[model samples]
Target: MPTVHLLDYVAGNIRSLVNAINQVGYDVEWVKTPEDVKNAGKLILPGVGHFGHCLSQLDKGGFLEPIRQHIEAGKPFMGICVGLQALFQGSEEDNNVPGLGVIPMRIQKFNDTSKSVPHIGWNSAINTGSDDTKNESFYGLRPTSKYYYVHSYAAPYNPGVLESDGWSVATATYGEEEFIGAISRGNIFGAQFHPEKSGVAGLRAIHAFLNGDQFQSLSQDLVTGKENGLTRRVIACLDVRTNDSGDLVVTKGDQYDVREKSGADAGGSVRNLGKPVDMAKKYYEQGADEVTFLNITSFRNCPIADTPMLEILRRTSETVFVPLTIGGGIKDTVDTDGTRVPALDVATMYFKSGADKVSVGSDSVFAAEDYYRAGEKLSGQTAIETISKAYGKQAVVVSVDPKRVYVDKPEDTPHHTIKTQFPNSNGQSFCWYQCTVKGGRETRDIDVRQLVQAVEAMGAGEILLNCIDKDGSNAGFDLELIRDVKASIKIPVIASSGAGVPAHFAEVFNKTTTDAALGAGMFHRGEYTVSQVKDHLQTEGFLVRQFET
Candidate 1:
């Protein structure tokens, strides 16, 4: 098998990239030291986290010169996400740090006032640098295909800027902001998207680059979308826990209760839905944009290193090409042997095991409370901050468990209250989303708005806004709750729980500005597949990414 050298300079879900590489008939050789870089014929640099940190680490490890030499020598090179950002002159994210200056451009942050900060979802990477009338594909990037992107900073796509300099560019639009999605010139190539998590389309690009298929004449039938932006993401979530018989199973809860109330077992056993890894693969095959796993039981009795959840993530990521988010028990803890482990270490373990993002649940609630107590000041010691700083804000997701607290008026409590369309039994029309902890068993004094704002300030990239009032209800998403949460912060918000059918997803997308919608019970019950939901979205005239084989 052919070998591709990967610079293992930082911590990330590099395993997925390796899996993608192996799937395309190429073997990965780790460039651990500067000496290893010399032996690399086809080098791939994957960057995640802060701009300064990625460059500084590369500089500190003595890899900058070797990488520079590799590029100067005209060796085949590819960069993913921040790895793409590393080739530019510098970035607004870290002005003090200098980039490799291969592209002769500086990266800038997206206009967050117009859209979400990280731009987390799938977007087009069409080769817009073609000089002729023909639609040409570069590095297997098609105008009709979409790739997964998650970042706040990118090289802004200015017409003819890179092309005049003998460079190829593929651009993606985010709320009127056209940015460089993929760029290539000579033997140097870079992608601001995560090709490994981009399904078969991404695999094809990886294959093309590895096989030296730089410019492919795309079929004339293939055309770019007339209206292109980020696609509405549909995620399949699996709530995993050990059942009563000590078997790990994917279970869905009604308002956080996993036991059946009127079945033959009649609340005597845990509702075992399916195996975690199997269900995840099924959803992936059904064209789910992403798969998420929440270990409900927290793996309390086992050591962190030996937990089965890591195995689940490893197995799921091997086949599921989209992003994989792992939640539950991501907080600081003590090992069985009495060694203290921080939450960042816990999250790193999952990242190493192939999780693209780590979801912080109760830990985030605690961090938010501490923030309010400290007069809304940030403590750099929090798990979200540490992980975000190390792996970029896009890798850290704050899973919010919130329930509605009805009130007669806005003055009912000292929290952000919204007038609701659905009144309570007491005829209360105003309510506040009270943040919860311990899987919705404990309620905190803080509200959803406060928690989201605090965490976003602390560097959280996305919010998994799960409504305790809607979990397993199968009615629909709490639109009021989703709208209120969306109004509070600028990061991507994933609406989870209370999805009964495909229309539920459509309704959420149509009524609110949710970045993504997640289905747990509806998908697990075998009532509807992820493809069905996507089909429904397409039928409604919304832009939906088709699942590629």
Candidate 2:
């Protein structure tokens, strides 16, 4: 019941801050003047747009002195995005303009060519100082829970700061420069990324901040116990595809042809298959939390079984401990007697083959009644229970790929028809896209919100939501889509598609209620390693899983 004051300057992402604060059960009061900061339980200063203009606005509103006073008084204060940069003495974005100088550092532009400007995508972080106890404050961050970042300049960690990344700073990079993503000074915490825009992980950070001592205890418990609030994972997916040899692959740019008998084959012989096991191994190593492997392909032909791929996966499972959720090309299985094959029996095969979770996609959407009939024939709950008994409930994950459809439109207008001339524009009249399955080959008339409710009702433990429009773009997560789905469902939501950098992960966690983030391209290409990503999240004060020292 704390009244949180969100400092409202002309240059802040007000909406994002408000939504993030509200998500964690805190009441927010938007304040533009200095007097509004008085006696507040907590304070959030969010900055966006131009740096000079933001400082001028804060000065005009007489907030600079009050904010400084609040921090000096040991009040819990969080600076977001530019707000973090503003704490430094100054930034290269506007060198002539001075910052608040709360922290002894200067913001500078990243000149690295390996990274892009505006530091738009998801990136990771690393800790530099020798103090593991201080560094472990950010330990609960899973590799997939990345924060969002959008900036041109950042404050590089100096002697006063404890850590920095290698490529960027403290194992985190923005624009390929080692920049400070987060700076903590006692009760004052600042993040270069928007925690409000980040999904559940961001919210958890906020919740931890609000809870104060309770969160500290939880952190201590996590490091000591190593397992609390650890529950069964449910994940959703998007943009799944196969390599030329019909092996699972996730990439951003070109399509590479798979050659038979190539060294890429796991069999090490003349086998016509790619190595999905190699891909899965990378995911497990990265701390997937869980994965929903959607086979993004035109399912006109019967799904081919990659026996060699499965064998590799089986062999890989002997080493990997994470759960694998497999979806795509599953319809109905029949025996010689014409009796339906049980879901449990089929799931058992996947389990025996090293898959901990079996996700039904096109089969669940296109043949709903038949799918349910099959489920009933196989005893739906019985199947789930059997799998739960066998591998534990945490291993059972159901993936629902639902798209948004406008509900306020006229009945006569075609659902897919574009009334406006520009088909790709983000217009107010065009409210949503209908959920499609069968590799986007079939469209479902149901609204995405409704579909989420339905999926949750179907006893699914999780939902992996993906935006077809945003898939494989390497831009950023579709935050609006994620926000909507997260608001509608109680089940955990794994935001997929459009994860280009570690900062994007931070944004996803800050912006929505998404429990996890799933990406294929950034990891596969060696742009970021799992530890690098996790370290970045930790520096930003996110709760992530950490290796016990």
Candidate 3:
């Protein structure tokens, strides 16, 4: 467990900083004074207020000297917002105030008015380095990822550092001048934008820094073993099913139980033969770093793991080598006249069948008793954990489908009793949705938040949050669900269900602290390729997965 030191200064958003770092699997300690930096494994300086005020606080707190010492010692350090600009010689926002001077540059105001100040919204970075060459910092990075830029001044481009775009300024005003939006000097990295707030790209960049050599080398050499320049990831999903002819087709399910419950038709269901592969290819072309194929019908139909379907995927993967995860019919135990087989064998089969990861849904939830029994029987935490330890957490995914159910209230009236639908502030007068299993057929009063925490405790590395309300609706993600789940859990969350467009991906990343986003309908219908989505996200300043071809 590596430790990350977050500088607590006047300009920093302490909560956002802590949330971002924790999302990437690291422990964070608040460093409000110079002494806090002395024994830090890695140091993060995040600022939100005025640059001059931030500098003054840093000096008063005596952090400037220790920070310099840490940087000179080749320790991994990062500067965000004003914290980033403060690392340069000085900023125009406050005249005569000196910066860390680690990079030979000064920040200046953008005198243009065509574009608004603070340069809000999303922007792309054009890699100034050779397109054919990539460094560890840029690994798994798409051409562009959405970065939230909020600044009036920018750092001028210098050849001594690698720039993401040709606009010399890290960020610039509409038509006036270019300024540094971000900067990197060996082990020291600075960003004009708040990566924590920047969404998935920001998270990916942070993760990369934590996992890359720069952070590793610094952490190793400095006894903290942390480096800079890591970013977060945004993912897209495509759900594949079989048509009458046994050819792979794409369709969306309705509310996760339309077929099982009220006999409602599967919303967005369509015959999309050979479309999933095409959409996946397009996502790769568009710069999607990774894509997932959720065989939505595998478990329902009890069909033998689709070998031909996987073969098509294997062939498609050759052209676009992004990480692929497949899920649906993974059984850990089979009862045939009291005979049982280990689920690890099924997982191994998936790995050999060309999946980078395997997801367990109904099997895990419906068989909780079995898993609990197995854990006791096998002397482990749970059956899932036992299998995960064998295959590695990265290779195991837990799919959680939760629905919102209103808590009974005396004032609440049935929808059929109302003449005109008047919406309440609480939205339908409902309380909270609990965790649902067995394809949304069984609603457990168990608290979803508690369940999320429990799963993490059970050794789940990641959670695929699929909203039963939004499933196959093409209505967009349930922001409330994503936001609540994100706030409550520290593990990376993959937001699934109700993704209608590429912008939806941007919105999810921008609005919540979710790590990766998953979609199926949009990709299945050829609505947007993963590469196209990545390109859009990259233009928005998101760091995405890059494809060589």
Candidate 4:
């Protein structure tokens, strides 16, 4: 086995890539400087950031020429995400920044039009070439091989030209466009999707790339959406808070204020419905595609010191096979000992405790405000950048808890206002989604649209769209909020808050561009199970992950 040289650009998920490679019995050596690239064996360039930013870093570190030389020498080389985009001529993301020009094609943003842009989540990659020799990167993958994707820009697929240019393309249709998913050109290969984050199929893809002949064809029955032809996720969200008795319980809140805090519970003032771990396990048993635990009160305390929260994750992961997301207080904090801890370190603790993703709410807004003050600047030290660099952008989620601020006219303020589906009491028709911090206690200058774009550039994988006004109201999801946020950003969005019934879930799925619909109040009140929601989604002619359980 040769040493797999993994390139680090100070922006990519070096940690997750290393873990994936090591899982398949391959030893990885991190390549930082140009000298490391020159001395590389079996090089792999994995990165995710602004297209221009990645290229600038590579050039500044003197890695461009050395990496090109290594690949030109016929060494096995691979690129992932931004790395793959870097191989093309340039990108629409930043037109001035030039790529390595290894391929003549220019990377373009998904031409989704009015649909979802980023095209996140699992999707099948149908191989264009029948011969394995032509499609070596997708060596053992079947026609419907599902790989996890998280990218807004992709290489344009010209089946004729790609095949003639010594590249075999596997394409996926996102909205109105069919873009390249994976490309293999001899020893030079690239994957627009993150193979490491693609789960079992992903692991196999990495293994086959490193250790030849290790790839095993999976059964069709094991595929996520083999029957439906497309994959959509159903998420179960648990709003966690401490009751009056100091016991951590899953609670439901209305309009960003939980029942426990107001002592307006139907059963008790505390609103202690059940334990976190127990409820999580119950949801997992009910065939939930994913689970999210939002520690509503963690904003007031140090999340790292929240032992019960970490304990819930550890215990739940042992039983829950799906992904687990934790939100609230995922920012930098000072410990009781007066030691300041970086937000990255805080996210690391959550990941170590079995959290697949961490949602940054208040911290993200602060980071964006800092960027706004610093001339559209971005620091690598921020929680979003650091966490994404370590765990991949797919692991970092930005929870946007925004409220509708109705006004007389759209142009009254400099914010992007939407015509409200539900008008205000004064009959004000236009409104702007005001971004909030500290669980909606304080509103920020930036709106939801600006925050979404800023955080995406800062390396947030997905956005957990939370509507403060509609939260726990059981009126249904804030469809207006969902549409506005979903249309603004290209990343995957999980529509949250104000889910009342099974029809609400279906409505969001059918009407909005959200990749997933999350429910807390409905699930907590025993109104609908995870399986029940999935069943309803399936019955409505929507694609959802089917479970025998």
Candidate 5:
């Protein structure tokens, strides 16, 4: 097998990149020091998180010059995500920090006025200079393919600006902003989106770059459309726990209950759906935009490094290219060996194990309550703060589990309440979403609005908003809750729970401003595949990412 040099810089989930490379028949060689770059024939820099941190780290580690020398020596080099951003001179994200100055361009944050700031999800990377007659896709890129992108800053696309400088560019539009998604020049390649997580389409790009095949012509049938915008993301969630037999299994809960409702073994055995790793791959193949495994079963008595969930993440990422989020047990805890582990360390374990993002559930509620108790002051020591600081905030996701608390009007109990469309048994016309913890086993004093706001201030990148009233109900998403939550936070909100059918997904997308929608039972029970929901969304005049062949 051929070998390509990869830089182990910063903290992120780079396992999938390695997996992608291996799948494409290339083995990865670590480019550890400045001296290592001179011997490399093909080098790839994979990065995530902040631009300043990426460039500053490389410079601090004495790698900046060697990388420059590698490119000047005309060796093949590729940059991904922040690795790509580091080629520019500087960015609006950090004016004090200087990039490699390779491109003489600046990256700017996307406008949040019309859409989400991070510009998360699948978007097209169309090569503007493609041959229309031959249907050439620059470096395995296609008009129809949508690559996974999650970033706040990007290089704004200006027609012929980089081309005049002998650089080829592919652009994707987010709202009204057109930005560079991928760019290439002699001996150099950069992708703002994550190719490793883009499924088969991304694997082809990696193969092309490694094989030095830039201008791969495509069949006209592959060019399905010129739609070049961020599409809606449909995520598949697996609630995983141990059954009565002590075997790890994927399980679903009804309003947070995971026991059998009826039978001789009623309420005796935990519901077993399937295996975590196998189910994850199945969803990926079914066109699920992302797969999440919430490790609901406790492993506190076991060592963090030896947890079974880590192994699950490791195995699942090898085959599932899309983003994988791990929730539950993300708080600080004492290991079985009497070693105290911080939440950041727990998150690092998961990230290194191949989780793209770490979702905080119960801990977030406690943190938010503490925040309000301290008069909205930051402690800078909480799980969210520490983790977000180490890895970019984009890597930290707050999983909110809230139950609807009914009231007659907005003034009831001094909580932020909305006029409810569905009245309670007592004829209450208003409701405030009260946050819950321990898988909705306990209710907190804080409201959902307060919890999300506090976490966002604490530097959480996204929210996994789950409604206790909706989970496993197969009724539909709590639209009123989703809308209120979306209205409160600037970061992305994933509407989870209560998705029964494909039409339910469409209803959430149409009725609410949620950035993404998640399905668990529907996908788990073979009731609906992710492709069906995406197809429904597409038919309803919405853009969605189709599974690449």
Candidate 6:
């Protein structure tokens, strides 16, 4: 049996890919050195990260030449996501850097201004050419097979590269342009979308790639394959922090402030309500479509050092089958012993600990600032871009904590300000949301709209729109804030904070185009269950998953 060698670089989704390949009964070996690449029977280069960084790492590790030689030898090889981009001569992501030139094309960032940049969701790939039944990638894939994609740049399909006798390609149209979704020239295969995360349709492609069979048969009943027809998701959030007793517990704070009064007790207010794993399992059992654990103090401490957070994830993942998102304190860290860790490495650890997506809060503010100052995303490596690349953008979410700054006139500030339905203390008529970092402790000059645009361009798969003013107030979601931010960006937006009742859940979904609604205190305190929220939405004529009794 031929073994599949997965190129384990700093920017690849090694764990997810390993799980996917292993599910198909293939033994995967990690390849780092050129010798490993040369000796491997079949090679797979998988990555999600910046164009220059990925290419630079490959060059520095001496795997570049071996990769080119492997493709030249006509042995079976596959390039996934960034790996597919690396096969091209260059990318617009970093114009100065060049790829391996295996495909003789230049990668271009999606340039259509009308559509969202990082096309982050389930989209379909269709056959672009004459019916070629022999194409390996599309062998068992049905027409218009929906696959999960998280990319800002892609290889522009050019017939010149299809000169090889067996060369064929499939296209996925995004915005106004059509780009190559899958490519195969002789024994080499590449896909811009992630098959590992695409469910059954994607796994079929992986199985076919391994067996060297052009066609794989599926049962007639299973023909209607797995599609990410994800409806509006209901997510349960647990704001976790260390209580006065130094125990990790879920706590809810009012307007981003969790304080215990001097009159309450010694030390501080005991906001410790419940344990993390316990709450997570409870929410999962209650039919939460997803669960999020925010290490409320993670910004002050290195996540790598937070063994408790990792344990929470490991324990919860075993019991919960739904998607899991983790946020708080996900920045680059330097240890006291002089050891430095990249932000992407931190994300890898989170994923390995069973986090399906890692959310960045303060780091996103900084990345947006740098990107705006440089006028291009090539300014510096950011956690959002790097992590999104390694895990695919869908696995990365940006949590924005924006406090509404009411202003009398929008023109007074350079940032985009919205007229308020409710007036401020001075009876101010207009307001602009100021993006904050450090758990909303420090405010920045950046506007929430500007930050959203910048992070989306930088490759954030989704936005966790949080309002510091409405947080834990239970008044309701800041509809103006959610609507304004949703109008500015095309990526899926999850309206966070200020959801008090079942009606509030329907209000956000009914009024705005938010892809999901998240609740914390309401669900955590037993006031309402995830099922209750879904029941209300369902009664309101909204599509919701009916929990199995």
Residue range with the least summed lDDT across 10 consecutive positions in model 5: 129-138
How big is the positional error of residue 109 in model 3, measured in Å on the Cα after superposition? 40
- The positional error of residue 280 in candidate 3, measured at the CA in angstroms, is 2.8
TM agreement with the true structure for every prediction: 0.98, 0.47, 0.52, 0.73, 0.98, 0.71
97 Cα displacement, candidate 3 (Å): 50
| Candidate 1 vs. true structure, TM-score | 0.98
Q: Residues 1-549, candidate 1, lDDT per residue (tens digit)?
A: 999999989988899999999999999999999999999999999988788889999999999999999999999999999899999999999999999999888999999896888889999988885433687778998888889999889889899988999998998999988999999999988999999999999999999999999998876556634345899999999999998888899998899999888868887788989999999999988989999999989877898999999999989888889999999998888999899999999999999999999999999999999998999998899999989888888999999999999999998699999998899999999999999999999999999999999999999999999999899888999998988888889999999989999999999999999999999998888999999999999999888887988
Which candidate, 3 or 5, would have the higher lDDT against the true structure?
Answer: 5
User: Is 2 or 6 the stronger prediction by TM-score?
Assistant: 6
Pick the winner on TM-score between candidates 4 and 6: 4
Runs in model 5 deviating more than 4 A are: 131-134
Residue-pair clashes per candidate, as listed?
2, 50, 55, 1, 0, 5
lDDT (Cα, tens digit) per residue for candidate 4, span 317-346: 655546678987788888766788888887
Q: Which candidate leads in TM-score?
A: 5
Report, for every candidate in turn, its global Cα lDDT versus the true structure: 0.91, 0.55, 0.61, 0.77, 0.91, 0.78
lDDT of 5 by residue, 1-549 (tens): 999999998888889899999999999999888999888999999988888888889999999999999988899999999999989999998999998889998999888887776778899899877645667667888888899998999999999999999888888998899999999998889999999999998998999999999777788777656788889999999999888887889999999899988988687789889999999999999999999999887574577788889999999999999999999899998888888999999999999899999999999999999999999999999999999888888889999999998877787678999998899889998999999889888998889999999999999999999998999999999999999999998999999999999999999999999999999999899998999999999999999998877
For residue 97, what is the lDDT in candidate 5? 92
Task: Score candidate 6 by TM-score against the native.
Answer: 0.71
lDDT of 3 by residue, 1-549 (tens): 577888876522244456567777888887866888988868888775466777877888899999999989988888887778877788887876788876556777654333323343334433333233332224222334445554556775555354432212233223434445555556776777666644466676677666653321111222221212223355667667776566676555567532222335233234453566776667656655456777766633333343455665555544444456677666655543344546666666555554655677766664454433455233343545655565445456678878765534524522111211323456655445467766677876454665665555555556789998788788888887877777776556788899888788888888886767877667666677666767777688865544433
TM-score of 4: 0.73
Residue 38, model 2: lDDT of 71
**Each candidate: RMSD to true structure?**
1.4, 19.6, 15.7, 5.8, 1.1, 6.2
lDDT of candidate 6 at residue 216, scale 0 to 100: 39
* Worst 10-residue lDDT window, candidate 6: 221-230
Q: After superposition, how far is residue 44 of candidate 4 from its true place, in Å?
A: 3.4
